[model samples]
Target: MSFFTRKKQQNSSDASLVLASLGGDRDAFCIIVARYQSLLCSVAYSSVGDVKHSEDIAQETFVEAWKKLETLQDPEKLKSWLCGILRFKVSRYRRKAASQPIEGAEDITEGEDHEAGQIGLEESAIREQEQALLWQTLEQIPANYREPLVLFYREHHSVAHVASALDLSEEVVKQRLSRGRKLLEKAMVTFVEDTLAKSAPSLAFTTSVIAAINLASPPVQAATLGAGAAKAGSLLKWTGLVTLLAAFSGVISAFFGVRAGLAQSRTQRERRSVIVLTSLFFIFAIIFVAGMFGFKHLAAQHIVSPTLLAVISQLWVLGFVFSYLWLTMYLLQKTRNLRAQERIFNPDAFTHPADSPSAKQREFKSNASLFGVPLFHFRFGTPEKNDGPVVGWVAGGDRAYGLLFAWGGIAVAPISVGIVAVGGLSIGAVGIGVLGIGTVGIGFVGFGAAALGYKAYASMSAMGWESAFSGGFSIAKDAAIGSYAFAQQVNNEQAADIVQLALFGQGYLWLLGTIAALVIVPAAWHSREVRRRMKR
Candidate 1:
């Protein structure tokens, strides 16, 4: 595993250096950083035409290289890989720079105009002016020619070093340098070469790169989500589940209570009171969920602290649960009192034939059964259909209940869809399930316009205790990507990549593709069955 000693690693082959680095020899990687530092800086300078930024970019390249070293399948081409990373870094930096407003040089020198600082100010101004002129001249030279010229000077005027670094012949390197010098003004030629040579990253650069690598968190290996991230994700999932359960239970209780009030024995006042109770229950639930959403939005904008949002979330769950319990108990007592009346239920209410008048009058009803469960059952709303709740293997209506699939205004099944949907795989305007997709969704994995989950992807707003990717705003404990994002890890692509890894482990794409195939094939078959039933 120790392919070379510290002294020998300086002259080690790229493959040997890589193997050694992978085997936990920091010296081998440090050697790599030192060996390629000048080449990277020169290449970056050719693109950005700024010495400081070029150095910063080069340092960033090394860090990225360290993190992604194992991804290099061909270690003999380490130089090419490093250059590729440098190019990506440069392009990203350019994009970020383009999005920001350029500050005036006056702003930089504003506070340093004191008599005591006059000498420092004058030197700084002159240095900045020379740098600006050098960059202007460098920009005139083409990239192909400019690259060799920069590398040649920065690598101590060695044509062979430039050639090897650029993967060109020594003669080609000499040719480009000659042309690059000719492209620059005679006065600027000497200045450019002197500046490049002097600005070549020193030994301190290698040390800093090593320090950065050592200080940074280790790259995620073949591992699941981190313990803290997983715990955070679980917390979020449970909180949402609790709220959803409360909503479901409260709504169901209200529905049954109102239905029970329709008994002939119940007074008109009691019936009206039950309806009022249902209305109040719905209003309170809506306000609770809406208030939570509003507070979360405020938290994303930093108008409220995340700590306050967390406290409110806990309180929201508690409040909903308590309110639901109170509603349920009140409904239960009302039901008990109503049942005690002598003039109980209507005899016709208990009679439901297969072709009942209510069933025939439905907006759309199809109960094509497979085994005990109906394979396809489509109706209209939550109002008494077939004198009772519609149940099916694949159901759809205003309210649908299915053994396998369901879709309507309110749906619940293994896979469900509606305006308000809940199931293992749920999709609707507001969806809550293990995997959910909707305008507002909450699940283990959620995707929507506004979403909350362990791994959430949203068009506008997202909050994932583990990770979140959003077009507008995002907040996460571990990784995040968005226009306005807050997380421990914020690199857009890297954060997304981490979420993928967390979701499906190492070879996630293959797993995701296979999952898609499995789901789609079965879903297609089910759709054909549903269509056949519709045709009849």
Candidate 2:
């Protein structure tokens, strides 16, 4: 067999062995662990910067893998699975480190030395000396550069695997590796120059050590050895499945909304509101879809040339900056609303919860006025009891929901076209068409389900079922406390209002439903709205 074929067969055999282990074969598991332990330990060592911690982390990873073996749908994906777990452990360590006070480099260096001692070194004394020097050089490099280099060379992972482990893009991983190599070379050169300047007795030995380190350094290969292509294909398949699920859910939500809208009596105000919102949703959806299609087309044709790519990158950064700004504004608005509610209900409210003596001891402080209202207050209390519905009437009324529906439509549109283009009149065409139809059909079902839930909440509120239930419950309680004026209970009307508010609160979700409704609903509300508005 060819080398590549042999490699594939070996990998397949390894997977079978792992599966056998999962089926209560301990020896098989030991063999699998023995094969992979060194690589896993190296990756953990790089991430944690201490050999002992790395080995401990590696052991924990194996334990976790053992526990989760049944959940492994594909034993071949074990490497990625293990790496993901190790990355998570490293992240947790980093977070813990960040929270603690900083320690000196001496402390870190000493800790690393102590950990390295745990791995008994019975090697030739000269070889041991060389390895120690190499480790020292590695420690000198910055954490970012060191981690990637170690993962690339020691673990022998592909650019994609490394990127996934670090939660970065493939391009970013490539860039980091390139930069890291340059830095490592520079550091080695510096070490040599400094050693020469000191005129140390071990100058000859140091020179040989530097040469040996360079020779021993692993070469940077183009791709990961064996199974990288298969892993990518598997990942893409899963992504497609998720996209299909999302599309189905969106359609189901939209169906019920449309039915509820149609069932409403021919009232001018109700009809006008529905008509306007629906029209706006459709217009935005179309625009969003068009933009997405254009973007994809540009990407495919290499029309996103170098200059265009740079511009797009800059725009992406700008978009993130603006998004952060908008998020901050939204948070501030929410805070203001909360403060306003607090003041309206009780001006002299306690600054902290009644249960907290420490907080109560703190004096209430009021800040200067803004627009005749205090901007800040130390005193706080249970906020005003809002008499409005528990859920907002406009919960799902945002333009963003429509935007999401439009985006989802755009995504679905491509798949639809692809199916038709590839499967035209072939025997397999029927299957493709059925899949497309079923996918869209299921999406509509999900939309309808969500809308039905919303309509129920609205209908229950309007019919005063909430108040009736509350009154009936009140009668069953002891007459003494029930008759007391201070005894307050929520009526059915209030309960229904709460439900209605919650139902509508997430308007963006409806857009997801609308996307689903496109295939499921007789006619999508957004589409119908688009046609109605076009007439005007």
Candidate 3:
């Protein structure tokens, strides 16, 4: 059966329909919708200007009215009550649209004459384009002005009626209309030259409004996640899991368990029946599972399922990266801060290099700007007047690029871009640094959410990788990409984590851990070797 079909409903007056609807009559509710849909739509259209949006407001209004039908004080005031709800919705719409207008002033043509020689079919289209642009400009105006401006002209509403609907004084409504028109005049948009035409609503419009109302969402309070946030991210889980897993897999744990009476291997009937260590195995299984749960909780991918879970369980990557970032950023800031501490000033843009201290200015590039900020800068010099290779080049400002060898150089300023960038977002290769590609991507050895990396991308495991792939989630990792074709989501979501190490020197986000391990392990190993050499 169709949603429009009313099996037992018959023609009813507005009073009768409202009373029946209030008494929980479904058919009567549908009848009420049929009767007032056109009126409600016209009221909404007058406030909003756009027909499609007006219909939507009418639909939502009727849906809300149905939900709160029992609260209706008077059946006669049903239309008035709905109009009140609609005004509120229109206000919300205007506020959202005001921030980002249809198009900025620069996007449109300054002064184009569409009506000059055009006529018949061509003129109609041109006029429509002009009207649309004008309407969009109207939406850009302040809401205080837009409401009365739309209501008065679109609804053919008199000052008294528009005032009554908006709960405003007629004088205030008049002022709004006047101010709104003045804003439009200064907006550089061509008015359609229409004399405020008003038209009757169609039956199709009424039916559609009712249908939309029937399909609207029900009223309910939204839930929040206060508890989950409070309990998230504890490092104890990883350490506890490693400890528990080690105890179970070790040789010493099984030997301590008793074998029935003698605490030895079973013999005769007992030997024929069982190893009798099943209880010990079961205990191990439980401990292993409990430990695994905690370990997985710390991992990013062990979360993020098809459900509405977060992308990261804990901001471990962010926490780790920001630590490195704090150090790097500090170093950069320190270099900038100490530049002025010297008694002998460094040679600057205007100063001759030879006139300054013995520091070599082997090469130089500079550009000046209107403000104090330099537009471009490039310089290679020895730090602290040292003779070590003249390896520092600091180039940057309003627009700058710099490269320093040995000690390392930084390029900065607005819109900075290069191999190493600080101020602006860097887009070059090598670092594979942080997030990229909005949605789907593949990189060989790539670590983050997406992949294609020539180096074996390592981390927890990437969404996808081969032998060149490293991460917690990659399937058939380096063996082949086609191995887990159907299971891409699992493989991708499982993405690998970069451990801090490499056969050569380490790079990648995981290098921090790798660096610590390399240093500590080598020192321990060498200390033992040194002690052995002394003992011999």
RMSD of each: 14.0, 28.2, 29.1
Per-model TM-score on C-alpha atoms? 0.40, 0.27, 0.27
Judged by TM-score, which candidate is best?
A: 1
Give me the runs in candidate 3 sitting further than 4 Å from their true place: 1-17, 23-49, 73-80, 87-131, 169-171, 186-201, 211-536
In the range 319-359, model 2's lDDT, one tens digit per residue, is: 43243335333433433354455445654442333313233
Weakest lDDT window of 10 consecutive positions for candidate 2: 478-487
Q: Write the per-residue lDDT of candidate 1 for residues 86-167, one digit (tens) a residue.
A: 9999998878776763542343345336422757866767766777888899899899998998888777788888889999
Off by over 4 Å in 2: 1-14, 97-145, 152-177, 185-536
From the highest lDDT down, the ranking of the candidates is 1, 3, 2
lDDT by residue (tens digit), candidate 3, 50-166: 555676677777788776654555555666777778778878876766765654223222222332334555665565475566567766778678667655654555878668656
- Give the number of the best model, judged by lDDT: 1
Each prediction's whole-model lDDT (CA): 0.61, 0.36, 0.38
